[model samples]
Target: MYVAVKGGERAIENAHAWLAEERRGDRAVPELSLAQIREQMTLAVNRVMAEGSLYDPDLAALAIKQARGDLIEAIFLIRAYRTTLPRFGATAPVDTGGMACDRRISATFKDLPGGQVLGPTFDYTHRLLDFALAAEGEPPLAPAGGDGDMAPKPHVMGFLDREGLIEDAPHDDSPPPDLTREPLELPAARALRLQALTRADEGFTLGMAYSTQRGYGRNHAFVAELRIGTVPVEVEIPELGFAVEIGEVVLTECETVNQFTGSKTEPPQFTRGYGLVFGQTERKAISMALVDRALRWEELGEDDSGAPAQDAEFVLPHGDNVQATGFLEHIKLPHYVDFQAELELVRRLRAEASAAQSDTRQEAAE
Candidate 1:
């Protein structure tokens, strides 16, 4: 239990003032503009948007600036701010199949339709820090690529679907349960699980996904496809009675095809795990896909050998960094009353033991 200390108002105000001062360090240095953060710190902004469940880059950048670049703190700030905003009707499900892909690849296929577009990626770059970046100078422009076909890229999984080699993921038109609006319930549906995993702590999800790769609830996953691009977001207008494109959002999507041997009830078709997240967060998307697959052990007719990723209760509750940080940090608050009670109990127990020993000694002397 934490009691409010009435006398600390002035001290708290002073501390807050000092914190504001600390947040704006070295007055001679020019302040970082929101535009700079939006452009340069794109990945961080993307992470905040994904985890905070908000898509405004400007707001995410502001949160980052206010939090002094502490990502979890920024996410916390963004989440708190999100609670104040008015909610509009939900947007229709984004059509990723029509994505204007910037980067698209498949580990399962050597060469596919629409071919490979490398785009701007750091995959092949040397890890060494360039001192040139420290000295500000405009870099040379990138060479233009060939004017390729403008047709929408077909999903790699579609080929396997035609051959009846992969399990069919029938489209569901029903409204999905909103985790934000309602409390998370156990035995969560796949849609809810995907929602949680998309915004889950990337490191924790990655670790859980890695554990599966190491043979704990192992499902031999092949990255059937990974794509990064912008897709049009459409929402049905009440007046118009038809969906219209509102805007575009960058998203990274992953589809993992896991080996599923034929069961008595089902066929030997390849099972699929899917992940989709805001912006170009491929690692999180991939990890989410792996963990998503692991959690489907019961549905896939595989035995649950007790893997952390497979436990929905364990994964979903702890995946949120904001909630995790809040719970973990709350202990640092004033807990003197609770501690005093614990101390008193320990003292009483020790005194009783000491008295018992003394009585035993007196009995011996008699």
Candidate 2:
């Protein structure tokens, strides 16, 4: 009896050791602390939390460092960790209407009930790189406002309702379906499918958005409103029998208005583009809105135009980096067995052809 090459287990163990050593490069560089990553590289932490669907900034930061700044890997780490966590309870959805907003603005209305506040945005900054950051100079602080009224959040939809410009946005109190718990099916409900897509990779989401812009299912969109801020998160403790504020989380919310192409029975109404994430990510929110609009082509009676965004099968299947990368990279594993089979078959076929050609030539000569 013949045996195949052994030491597969040993090889795997050594490779893991090498990887661990590589991950902790430059022992003198002072290891990155979770707090530093959480506070300084907050954007990276935010992305990890948003995509991983876990809001712990410190955890996300640690994942990022462990992943060597690979954001997608950090997200994967968070997702894996999230599965082992104990389920306590869920918080009621924060009334975005009651949000103690740090930043709020609307492009649709010149002035609304709640006045626009351009809180923290890089929008107005010049494109030139700052040389001061190289040396890490302390910058002067902007004048702080006193008695900043903690005003209740106001809705952009409310303003449209007052003007009779948009269809009344529905507020259903029923619990939405969980995308993570169930397998995805086509002709999906907006709530279920959108939740799945929100945690989707930024590059993938961006590609879908780009496809929509390139005439796949172009929907004219306006950023009706966008806001980013912190909100109190309350949880109901069963033993205490009372809801209590457990924590606060920062979130980015985006609402977009799109041209409402009406059907035979339905009247012309402005469609909505919605995106909500765990941090102040304007680009992600805006991109999400555009993609959301493109995905609504069927409901809007817009022609498919064979765009990537309009094709649910294509978009949904390829939207996740974790799944896509795993499946794609899995091809590298021990395919030598398959390769050997193909190689033998090709050689056998060639030998058979050569023999047949020689026999035919002899017969012709004779």
Candidate 3:
């Protein structure tokens, strides 16, 4: 029973004003520019874009700035703003196999086609923090690369396919279900599950993926390929009767080859788990792939170990940080009426028990 309480308009206004003041922080420090957040805090912006399901870096940076570095808050803002935009036509599926890769590597094979190109990465960096970064100074530039042939690299999984070692990827020309437009239905298709996982909270997804690695729903996975690069997006224009190249967007794609035992009607072969996300978010991409494989227990004819990662019902609903945060924070709101009702019930039960005890004592004395 929620009773409307009035007369806090002034207080509410003042509270909002105070919040704005706090968000601004001390006037002595220079205000952060959107460009700084976009360039310097690139990872943070990428996270906002990935989780918020919006591709615009500028808008993500603005949301981060407005939310005062609170990423969940930024995601909420982006999602809210996303609902207001007019619908544009959907683009063709990106050809990741033809990506102009900046970073590409394979864990399963020592040497593959399109020899490894280690772009900007933190894999070998020491954990030590550089104190010099605190001071504002221009860093030295990297040396120019030698002239080399620029061509699309072949997917590493192609090699495994030649030997019939891995299961073939299923091709579907039908349009996939849109979670943004439709409410989630249980027993979702792989495409829908992938959609939800892509926008899921990174921490939750990471933990779920880690659980699989730790023998919860163990799928012996090898990184067949992990590529980060820019891919062209094209949309078919009805008026022009042809597709035109729009722009390129950076994406990270991971394909994991997992061990699979042959089922009754199938030969033993490695299975695949795929993950693709906006921007250079390799961690999230890898996590998504692991969880993706775990959720494929039914399709792959694997035993249901009842792992949390394998349960779509359990994983999908709790994955969105925005939804989880909203439910949790709502408890901080006015629950006075509900609490009062519970209190009264408890008091009544105690009184009844006390009166019954007194009656029993009187009857015994008599």
RMSD of each: 2.4, 3.0, 2.5
Clashes per candidate, residues 3 or more apart or on different chains: 0, 0, 0
| lDDT per residue as tens, model 2, 1-366 | 123235766677898899878888999988778888988888788889988988999899889988989998899899889889987667967767767777888988778776888886677899889998889778777568522226876778776767767755645576877665566777776776578678888878877777767666776788899888878888877899987887788888889888775778667878777888888777777778888777877766767788778777887767777787789889988799899999999999999999999999999999
lDDT (Cα, tens digit) per residue for candidate 3, span 134-232:
897788886686222257888888898999998989556778898877878998889999999999999999999999999999777899899988888
lDDT of each: 0.89, 0.79, 0.90
What's the TM-score of each model vs. the native?
Answer: 0.95, 0.89, 0.95
Off by over 4 Å in 2: 1-6, 146-149, 170-174, 236-243, 353-366
Model 3 local distance difference test score? 0.90
Model 1 lDDT, full chain set: 0.89
lDDT tens string, model 1, 158-214?
999999999889456778888877767888888899989987988889998999999
Once superposed on the true structure, which residue ranges of model 1 sit more than 4 Å away at CA? 1-6, 145-150
lDDT of 3 at 55: 92
